[model samples]
Target: MVLPGKGYRFHATGLTHDERGYPDMNVKTQDLLVRRLVDKIRLNADKIILVDERWMEDAKVVVISYGITSRVAVHAVELAREKGIQVGSLRLISLWPFPEKRISQLAGKVKSFLVPEINYGQICLEVERCAGGKCATISLPHMGGDVHTPEDILAKIMEAVK
Candidate 1:
């Protein structure tokens, strides 16, 4: 998460607070800060939004994953490839300020996206939104306590190709 620089301070209601400040309660101030942050993210997107894409040129299915699940997705992608499936992998290194443009571009090319996440489905929702109905977004959701097995993701990948 991003944090304000040291010695930075916050002001609210025309009163400056200490270094450890309270939330900015002013709507106008909040809006300005949010807009600035978004602009920064857009201006430096290439540096801020990091992703690792592999074997996408002729892929019918792209597996989108991140964090620990990304590690698992790697093995799954290898397994699918061994079976001669036209599958690819996209590992998200920066979750926030999502790589929407890349996802949207890929959505137009691929038949579907398989999102294997440890949650009930968070990032998968973002993938679905960015895909914009151009392609299917499948969520292989695991409700915590354990990560998805390679076979589980490979199964979904096979289903997606079909």
Candidate 2:
């Protein structure tokens, strides 16, 4: 089937790479496409800040997240607040480029940022970069595809506060 946003064409048949046990070239193409899609998502998100709030004029901790991951992050922030932690959240819908300026602004007010993501700390690196050394940053990472529990993230938030 033809894919949207890309061109498709027919070419003369070549050797049967997969039939001989060699990896299918299509698989590589698919990987490239996935990578491109991810890049696009990140680029689009560069300017958008999905969530923004400041609990105090000089809060010490801020949380940043994206997509389904963001839901759990919100929960964690709420729980942290209830427990008297001066934590705030900035949920990012876009992830590739990251929200650098917003993070820099947060760094001015907070001492640390708690980054939670489904992957094994990929986005956490970006958070650290955006933090610009104005604050310390750490991650609450989940390697699984599923979302992390609020208690899990809240626990990290608790740690960052200390």
Candidate 3:
């Protein structure tokens, strides 16, 4: 689900809804279903949660971004690298069932994580939780009229390294 910038508009025609029957809401049945779903997600997490890590070797700081924001982050990471910042780029291709294990591992290795998102700090919260106070998690939030400039992300990356 791509959350576009504010004032971004599109027209969808001939959209059809698949009407699945109402979920079984009996307490016992619901509990069982929920447990099964959680198990399924856990079992497939390695396959479902996609993350792209770049320049991570010996990185002191990592930039974590998703959706459209990840695109901007790539340029910012490249610029940071050109300036010789020991920063890595971690683009989250799948947000749900988040890559907490990777974040936790990196937290122990890196000084901080910079999460720049078009929204006001959703994924950053998860990053912070996963870091578990092992390292700093900086939220570079944008209010969503448009995507953040690479310079903005680069500035945060610079801050994170410090």
Candidate with the greatest TM-score versus the true structure: 3
Instruction: Write down the worst ten-residue block by lDDT for model 1.
Output: 11-20
Return the top candidate by lDDT.
Answer: 1
Model 1, global lDDT: 0.88
Off-target runs (Cα >4 Å) in candidate 2 are 1-58
lDDT of every predicted structure (CA atoms): 0.88, 0.75, 0.87
**Model 2 Cα shift for residue 102 (angstroms):** 1.1
- TM-score, one value per model: 0.82, 0.66, 0.83
Error of 3 at 104 (Å): 0.2
User: On residues 1-162, what C-alpha lDDT tens digit does candidate 2 reach at each position?
Assistant: 355456544232243233333445687655765676677776667444355554645467888878788888888888888888888888776554556777878787788988888887888888888788989988888888578999899889888989
Report the C-alpha lDDT of model 1 over 1-162, residue by residue, as the tens digit.
234565545433334322244455566766776676589988888788899998887899999999999999988998899889999999999998899999999999999999999988999999999999999999999987988999999989988999
TM-score of 2: 0.66
Candidates in descending TM-score order: 3, 1, 2
Question: Which residue pairs in candidate 2 collide?
Answer: 42-96, 45-94
In model 3, pairs of residues that clash are none
**Hey, what RMSD does candidate 3 come out at?**
9.9
lDDT of 3 by residue, 11-65 (tens): 3323221222234446666666667668999988988999999999979999999
Residue 41 lDDT (model 2): 71
